[model samples]
Target chain A: MASADNVGILGWGAYIPIYRISSDEIARVWGFDDKIPDSIWVEEKAVGAIDEDTVTMSWEASRYALMRSGIDPSEIGAVFVGTESKPYSVKPTATIVAEALGIPPKKLASDLEFACRAASEAIRISIGLVKSQIAKATLVIGADTAQGAPGDLLEFSASSGAAAYIIGNPNQAAAVIVASNSYITDTPDFWRRDGAPYPEHGEIFTGEPAYFHHIVNAVNGLFEEYGFTPKDFDYAVFHQPNGKFPLQVGAKLGFDREKILPGIVTPYVGNTYNGSALLGLAKVLDIAKEDEWILVAPFGSGAGADAYAIRVTDKIEEKRSLAPTVEELIKRKILISYGEYTKMRGKIRKYER
Target chain B: MFKDSVPKYWRLRDVVYRLKYIYCRDCGKSSFPPRSKCPYCGSSNIDHRYSKGNGVVEEYTVMYQSEARYQDYQPIVFGVIRLDEGFRIVAPIVDVDPNSVEEGMRVEATLRRVRVDGSTGLIQYGIKFRPSRR
Candidate 1:
């Protein structure tokens, strides 16, 4: 979906919650097998405070995006939030985020729900919005306070974080979107029924049939669409469910570990669900060089994928100081106990009045 | 004592979302919790303004006692922030130890869930100050 116009990411920002709980600690609390954490390939996961949720995280991230873009928030015409854990099931997360960012009251806003790919879809729509001259710019966000049932295997990787991008013309862009493609299906590898507190996955079924299938199809489609091969990309970022998924998928796509390592954050931050792949892209955008081609593929369960080919621009270096980099937020963390994590995440239930 | 109807929450969204204040063009004085008319000069020459959310603690107090709805987060600390814009505001301080906060300490506003409405079980989100981490 590379638009005819230069509809690329003008600015990018990310927010990782300050609190974290190590996999070892979660394992210890649950009395799980010591070997299980190793299989997840994650050391720790970000945990939002009880006061924080998808709306707050998305707003913070959007603030940084506005700072980096150096655009009046009111000038932007669209605000889209992609998340699986929106605070209110019916209320749109986009309006709260737009208001917090000082975006104009009259604009398009919506909460997209397609698992993790919702934000990526928002990005594609932003490209269309900017290309059609319908908007001066558009804000697309991916964020989540992802949860797994207590003592469940998914707990090791479910995490909280957010990433946002302001997409506009190349004059203000950090990178130009060279091309994009998506693959979708009725795969229900992961889902949370209405009123369910945490999501459930089909274990191995989440791997082969859902994540891998969508990602490979979308990326292969991108390659075919643009007549480009893996060697043309300087770096590759695949959706990271666990630390291993990105690397495994990257290898399958003919990318080396070195090319994929820089974009992978789940090893330390765990999976941020909707924020997972976009945050990785933010990390790449933070360090990518002029004309370097970076391939990003986001796979969301239930399930679909969006693959993007982006070429970095020199402007990225100039806007780096406008907001805190993703690395800075990732490093600004304090380790919390499993008990403290529960308290901060509000997992503790109250029984007394 | 934190029960809010939906309209009240929506009405005060500007105060919490981005610290949007109002400037009295007639007197050049700024007032928060935006007003329809200028407070200082009693004039209608008012303009919308924003606070950078950076300030210093003018005074602070720690409360160990709490209401039933806030028992989980007891010992709440509140401060009067002397903002860079030359106005002062009272707000709860977070992400810092309750006892460590002192007057003249640097603080920044961050969006957070302030209190939950007990009657409606709806959460109220607002700006809360915290020690400037940077």
Candidate 2:
């Protein structure tokens, strides 16, 4: 087996749907004071039309990663789909995506559900696959069409998006996986009861107890264990439920705003749940120079964080031809009305039948 | 659910018989029964579109018994057929001996009544594939 550091990301891709819904409109309908920032912190949110879901979004992101990596689908030895919003309760969303991508049945495939951090977990699992030589390439996808009760803060921010990374041997990698650390706690700040349409979350409790505590702990742990200071990293991205949290956390950690600002995606697209932080990291990698260091920390509602330190490589410049950059996606947005947002979010009517 | 009260189509799905499958024009993919959209391309842009309905058997298995509603038709033959257009479907083969069903054997889709619920229930028709006439 190869050393753990031998495994790294070979390629990365992201997808944020074309639609956007303004926060001011949400504040008007919910009767909140217009002066107050809508709970989401974004002017608008991206939504997936009826046909899109975690499975579809993951497929799109994976397709781009595969194309960018120039790796054949048949060569993928394992596929992990990290999602909270699976299409079916019993069926595995990974199998659906694997089949569509033409991954053979002999490969290891499964779905992971750990609130928002599931995709980061998938990345770790793929790293193990590459290090052990069990597979030459593994595809890790984090995607969600997250839902929140209508009129709740989560509703304004819970959006749809996906991100995928192809993990393989470092010598064959597009970016070197330097170090990773995790901080976990059994906190129930947010949860959805079974058969419930939307998730219920504790308002202020989600911040300090769940998001801030876990992310800060993981980032500090990574720095301490790896013997690197915050300044050693060039780019940092966090699981963004809203724009304010990442900036606030960065300030507390003694990091400047400019270091974190470039990777922030929530202010424009709202919270993508599972895809939030990872998609931002994908955006950063698109423009980062070779050998530049990057720090990624993702937090979930149940209270867990996965922090990775990566170093970009020359291969990223070559692979960029196959996938769309964050700038391209942001520029191509389509505005939608408040009522359309309700319909797209599946809050207005039951159309599954 | 009681065997007698079950719908004819639900009961027919139990018995061994061939049925027709349809493909969509926009995506060029075949599906069993029929679907409103191509699951791969997610295009509602679909047509009832006929199936060339001919393919080769991909795999097969025989069952000793089926559900209570299909108890009358014991010993069922089930298999997945790979169509000529590159889509695969699952169904029961008919009008041929069980031993004769092998992988790569040419088959054609046909309309057949798979099962009848009780004595006075509706006769449900479905599309199933069988040994091709050609």
For this target, which candidate reaches the highest TM-score against the unseen true structure? Answer: 1
* Global CA lDDT computed for model 1: 0.86
Error of 2 at A222 (Å): 1.0
Off-target runs (Cα >4 Å) in candidate 1 are A1-5, B1-3, B36-45, B118-121
Report the TM-score of candidate 2, chain B only: 0.71
lDDT of 1 at A317: 86
lDDT of 2 by residue, A79-172 (tens): 9998899767776888767765668787999999899999899888877788788988999999999897778867678888889988986876
By lDDT, the best candidate is 1
Q: Pick the candidate with the highest DockQ.
A: 1
Q: lDDT tens string, model 2, B23-134?
A: 5678777665556677778777765543456789989987777776554334556779887766687877754558778988999754444444443453343455667643
RMSD in order of candidates: 2.1, 14.0
* 10 residues in a row with least lDDT, candidate 1 chain A: A1-10
Instruction: Evaluate residue A336 in candidate 1 and report its C-alpha lDDT on the 0 to 100 scale.
Output: 87
Prediction 2 TM-score vs. true: 0.72
